[model samples]
Target: MRTVGNDLVRSQLHENRKWYLGLGALLVVFGIVLLAALPFATLTVIYIFGALMMLGGIIHFIAAFKIFEGGYRWFWALFGVLYLIAGYYAFSTPVKTAIVLTNILAIILIIAGVIRIFNALLFRAFQGWGWTLFSGILTLVTGVIILMSPDAPFWVLGLFLAVDILFQGVNYLTLASYIRREVPKSSAEQ
Candidate 1:
């Protein structure tokens, strides 16, 4: 028998199934587009990134003034200003922005990979820790390769991003399905 709390959780998941499915469909569409435009992905990605940055900059700028209190309020404003400038520059020179963003992505991946490896090491007490370590190593290697040749095969980045997005979408859909299946059962039991 399931508890009331379990029924609530299941019901919530069931109610939100449509949202998950919608998100999954959206991501799958994006992945299809990326695959279809594999050849033009390099230039296309530049513009996409530029647009995203500009949009993010606008959001950041708006957020800057919303801080009611804090010593770092101005600091956020300064960063916001920088974001605006960078966004404008990106929109103006998308190719340049692409290269820079790729390099930045590489560096970030490297850092994240190192952190993951360390975390995996600390998780030695847990089972299947080796898988985490292996993934970390793979991530680290990929970062290093990207850092070495950020400009080479730029389209691959788009392809990979698309694939990653699609996978995330599928995961959401699967979770939603599981919730839908289990929720009704739990409620019925209750």
Candidate 2:
């Protein structure tokens, strides 16, 4: 049983250290570039989203044919058409789509914040519960600010995407370094 937490995984990561390093470097570069060109990155994200929606629509259309149930087939077909329409709309009016998506994100964040706060409060005895409560409050405030801001939609998603990618890149780099350091020690011990 070579679980990810074990030495086998560490050995594999050591073996693939170069790949992780390269990917981390690439993502870090991309994140920095996106952060530099925030507006362009925002539009790029919308375009990518539109393309994904179009792909999803096509998949749904194919699925409709594969589904033998009449109601399911019709439902898939209907949703496929809707997805295609939405994709087209996104492509034609990306800025509007971004704004709409950002607004939705705000709503989702608010909901998540409330849920986190409720969980933290309900599980007061849990270790680090106060941190969870603090995080929830911050999330709630952020969501409120984003929702209220007229200019938030123009850059919020792009900023979030850039930051997420940047962090992921750093995480990859850290994992690679850790594996590189520890694997040699483990090998020597064995």
Candidate 3:
């Protein structure tokens, strides 16, 4: 039997269904646009990263003098200089930076995949272990493919981001539709 609280909850959901659907549609559109212009998106990310690194270096430099002393001050200053040099290199040669970043990501993923797989094995007695194993294998495969491909670094990040956004949008749309379908109807309406 449906309770008054259930009906109220359903009504609330019904009221917000349009907002969910609208946001989902907007995200879907944005994801598609980003996917279409992937190279530009990739470069945009690189440039943004470069800018952030530069900003971080400046902050470190300021902190060194203002917040540190002796060896600590020298350490922060050195760190800041390294950051600035790295940031400048990134900005000056984005393609090389992307390649380096992509390789690092691939290596990390591979290591994580291996670790997850082992963890899943060690915890095989637990529920959901199979899912963990599956995820590990999938992650491993993705990393291997990216590492092996000659040009994967150039576009993998952009493609992954586009797909992630697309899936999130789909999830929102599904939730909105589910809410609409689940709303309780009055006896007369039923």
- C-alpha lDDT of residue 42 in model 1: 60
Q: What would the TM-score be for candidate 3 when compared with the true structure?
A: 0.75
lDDT (tens digit, per residue) of candidate 1 on 87-109: 68877876676677777778778
TM agreement with the true structure for every prediction = 0.63, 0.86, 0.75
Global lDDT of each candidate: 0.75, 0.86, 0.85
| Cα deviation of 44, candidate 3, in Å | 1.4
lDDT of 1 at 22: 96
lDDT of 3 at 100: 90
Cα lDDT of model 3 by residue, 55-103, tens digit: 8899999999999999999999998998898889889998998889888
- lDDT at position 46, candidate 3: 81
Error of 2 at 172 (Å): 1.8
